[model samples]
Target: MNEAIMEKVSADPFAKLLGIQIIEIEEGKAIVSLNIKENMLNFHGAVNGGVIFSLADVAFAIASNSYGQTAVGIHVTINYMKAGMFKDTLTATAEEVSKNPKLGLYRMTIRNQDGELLATADGMVYRKKEQFA
Candidate 1:
């Protein structure tokens, strides 16, 4: 992945707030992790759903743009399967599900340190016209 793109993403407020890291970026996938902190919890002390969603969203952003050809997210359907508690690291891995000349479908999972799934998402990305594939 491009260093400039990584810089632009890491500068986002929510990413900085949650302390998310872009662990790996490859041709068609991206993995991001967040080390949960005390401030990330809600009134009940459970990690907020928005935080999990953000992690997945960022993963999608990086994955969609990983090819060095810009793309935009058309939609994403996210599901919260479990609550993340305690201070722990959460990882999200997004992979391309399908692709055509113009559209790509991707899915990602947010997992706890133990590899237990906390959330899942399916995203649609629209690739722009460019000489690069």
Candidate 2:
């Protein structure tokens, strides 16, 4: 199941475009990493909040869909706590907070290589009856 989930996430074009890498994934958790690049920086010369949010979203998507059922994000809220610098490797981890037959809630955290918290997010997804192909 993990292998299949990894394969599915590996093919995500948006994730690939942002250089997000899947570090780990299980039934209701996932870890993804990204290396800060020049293009990812904002006018303030810090990694853009969108980039951090994208990393967290990737982790959330992976964890929510880890069950092999199609899950689509319905809502998400993120809080940025720190800035990421160039060359910094950021990792985002998502874990299931709660779930039922049709909905799932996940909590995600982004941290730098030194384990400093960068951002946190909560996401909810609606599970579909269809399974991944």
Candidate 3:
């Protein structure tokens, strides 16, 4: 499903225009990254919060689907610990904190290339039964 999701997301003309990429997927975790460019900067010349949030969300989407089942986010709360700088390849990793038969909890950290913590995110996702189940 990761490959399928990536294809669907990348097939979008707008995302293609923005050059977004889904980098890697691992066990109960995902690594997503994008370089901060001029268009992504806010008024103060820092990376926009929406961009950071989207990256974190992408990581969550991949990690929550880690167990070979579908999952959908029920809640997501993000704390902006620090401002993200421009021109850096912002990376976010989402790790599953806990899970049950019907629920999953995840925490994600957004960091700059040098490993400075930019934002912290937590989300609660509900696991869905597989279509083939």
TM-score of each: 0.86, 0.97, 0.84
Give residue 26's lDDT in candidate 2 (0 to 100): 86
What C-alpha lDDT, on a 0 to 100 scale, does residue 66 get in candidate 3?
61
In candidate 2, what are the lDDT values of residues 1-133, reduced to their tens digit?
5567678878999999999999988899999999999999999999999999999999999999998889999999999999999999999999999999999999999999999999999999999999984
Runs in model 1 deviating more than 4 A are 1-13, 130-133
Which model scores highest in lDDT?
2
The models' CA-based lDDT, in order, is 0.85, 0.95, 0.81
The parts of candidate 3 lying over 4 Å away from their true place are 1-18, 131-133
lDDT (Cα) of model 2: 0.95
| Clash pairs for candidate 2 | none
Q: Model 1, range 17-127, lDDT digits (tens) per residue?
A: 667888998877999999888887888988898888889988998888777677789999999998998687999999988877689899999999999999999999998
Model 1 vs truth, CA RMSD: 2.4
TM-score of 2: 0.97
Ranking by lDDT: 2, 1, 3
Q: Taking the tens digit of each residue's C-alpha lDDT, what string does model 3 give over 64-114?
A: 876567788999999998888768988899999999989999999999988
Quote the positional error of residue 63 for candidate 3 in Å: 0.5
Model 1 lDDT vs. the true structure? Answer: 0.85
